[model samples]
Target: MKKFRFALALALTAFVPQGFAQDVQPIDGIAAIVDEDVILQSELDRAVRNITTQYGDRADQLPPVPVLRRQVLERLILVQLQTARAKSTGVRVGEEEIDAALAAIARQNNLTPDQLRQQLAADGLSFSEFRASLSDELAIQRLRQRFAQSSIVVSDGEVDAALANQASGTQYQLANILVALPNGATPEQIATAQDKIDGIKALLDRGEMDFQAAAVRYSDGPNALEGGDLGWRSADEIPSAFTNVVGGMQAGQVIGPVRGPSGFQLLQLRDMRDAAGSGASQNVTQYQASHILVRGDDAAAKARIDALRARVGAGEDFAAVARDGSDDTVTSGQGGDLGWFVHEAFGPQFGDQVSALQDGEVSAPFRSQAGWHIVQRTGTRQTDVGAENRRNQMREMIGQRKLEDEWNRFLREMRSEAYIDIRPAAGVAGVTDGS
Candidate 1:
């Protein structure tokens, strides 16, 4: 997926010269209106061009231009609806947050922010446009998270079934390309999709194209932009249709053109691993630690932390120093005791520093997102592998599956409820049934 992002950058770069050659103004109008929000024809045209560029040589394999335009317009409507909904619910993202996300994307491409801007310009994309798109993406994400938390529920039976499957111990890192067949499609459509997938498989067999590239070009799955990456999953987590087939495949091997409810799917086994005890286990190290936090203006905070570290190093009791100097009111009176915690409980910065310490070792002052801190590791113990942890993991897995389903349904319902009016030039008047 990281590689795919870089590919996206390169693909956009190719559009620069052509974009510059074209007239600055072309006819543009409304594509669709979602409640108070509107999708612009210009935006739809750009999206179609992007999809074409991403697909490269395989662009011809896509649906008819009119069908593709409608599909893109529908997606835009969904996005506008979600963004509108987010604002109504008071979901907000700060400019700082968007900048941070852009910085991360730059870092992924090994470029500085300025360099990333230059790259975007070279790709014919204005920084402001890119930032606006990213902000909308983040807003949609926040909206989905809010909905998922309230709507998703996992049953005990689901957890038990998940655990039973986990007991098989095998897990796979898989990538897939799907050629989707619409519901109640005629035999001709099915045969055409099959033929398309067969051609894809033949290309894979001949090593004409890599899996990631092919997925970006041809996959109909939601993760197509991420090269159809499904991440790592245990057998039970996989869709039932591909479970047995993937179990029998080897790493770096491609399988399928397998028929399933949604469509014909081609899968590649990227890698695999085994969980402990022929089943899932959650045995992990837990830390008991304490910290002294100091917050002031930057220089003052640094000075105070330095002084506190010196005092503790000079044989002052850590608990005494923490009680006297720490800023965390809840833990300061308790001598900064954080109680027992798993590594993830405190996030990477705190967890990593604590993990590096031996029992009774005090760490050098470090800064986290919160502020400066000097931590003392008092003890460590391994958590027991048990049914409780397994059940918790199972619940999370089940919840994620339910979340995806519900989110899709939610989008469909939103589209159905919206008063959408697609203009004639947009070329998609009657095709979108909230699918």
Candidate 2:
């Protein structure tokens, strides 16, 4: 029955054609060139159509089609460049991994994989196209991970500073407008960008234009169409350039023409909240758990794990099983006694499974970064609000902030360094350069 369902999904996907792949293909050409790769006009058309489908009701808030086309084209070029770089660096994602990712996405949306394919067909997207897009996204994520791992490092001093500022607790819901300057901009070009930002600030100051309206018209940042909304971010979450300035502003106030690495930035303080009293405060759950680790490859290991799981399921002692069959020396002799530790002390995969188990409940065998194992949740406790725990949490938060900032800067630098050429589309002005 499962095989039949899988075959039926493939059949549906094969029979359903993409809108652009009809009997008569639309006249298509190159939209942009990134290093050795090309972005096709049809791809751009499809992306624009998808965006329109997503935000059609807010059409007035979107930039003009020509401008939107240029922005989307630039984004495509970046993706192509990143994918190529990832491939060059030997980053690979397997079919099994992609399948797992797809299954996870399906579960998130309350649908099966077959239902997901059918929904994509109904929306005029091919399942193959969807998979390919997912693959590219995953590849880009892997590439970013590699870059972040190599480049970002957090220090104790930075963590101390972050904790010191934690008392402020002020988080800003911000909207931004960026008049972006070209990479390696000349003095005159910098001045021109500044003048453009000043004009935008003037209009915003007099209430002639609202923040969203101004953003849609003039912001160069990617979220311009979404009213340049940065959503709710704490001071630590934001880039340093705007941190000092945002602290002084009140809700509904617009302030900027501030110089940044990218260009001139206009910030509107949409709202503010106290993070200390909010849900963002430092708090965590610690779990007391233990597992029997069976290390071997493929079928043999899986069979051993299956038998062990059955033994435990049939009321055999887990500790006895660990002592006899477990490969981990540290815990096997102690009957798999892992002392109380924060969930994050283990990796996310292990942490997630451990968190889901109730006290005194045993999980079915599951695979983690280490190996396949069954985890027993002996107990759980909430961490108290102690100075040491707070300091540890602050250090983690600061490290995350640094990583995010570094990632953004890395992308900017990547775009600047890549060799790209934008070809003009008929009836649309070409994007000659990126900001």
The TM-score leader among the candidates is 2
Model 2 lDDT per residue over 1-435, tens place: 011122111122111112323232464887767777767777677666655655658777666889777666656666677788889999998898789778877776778989977776665555676677567667777887787679777778887777776657677898889887766789999988888899988888787888897887678886676678888887777767777778888799877678877678988889998766442435568899889888865888889888888989999998999888898899999888898988778788888889999998998888875778888999988876466765676666666667766765666778888877676762244355432
Give a tens-digit lDDT track for model 1, residues 1-435.
Answer: 012142221122212211222124464887766677666666677667766766679775555677667656656676678879988899998999888888888887889999988877765565676677667667777888789778987888888877775546667898989887765679999999999999989998998888887886677766665677989987766766776678889899988889876689998899999765634356888999999999754998999999999999999999999999999998999999999999988789889999999999999999987789999999999987566766776788677766755675676677667788777657763354323
Q: How much does candidate 1 score in TM-score? A: 0.70
**Which stretches of candidate 1 lie above 4 Å from their native place?**
1-27, 165-167, 170-235, 238-284, 296-298, 310-317, 329-334, 341-358, 364-370, 384-392, 429-435
TM per model?
0.70, 0.76
Worst 10 residues of 1 by lDDT: 9-18
Error (Å) of candidate 2 at residue 65 is 2.5
Runs off by more than 4 Å, candidate 2: 1-27, 278-289, 293-324, 327-393, 426-430, 433-435
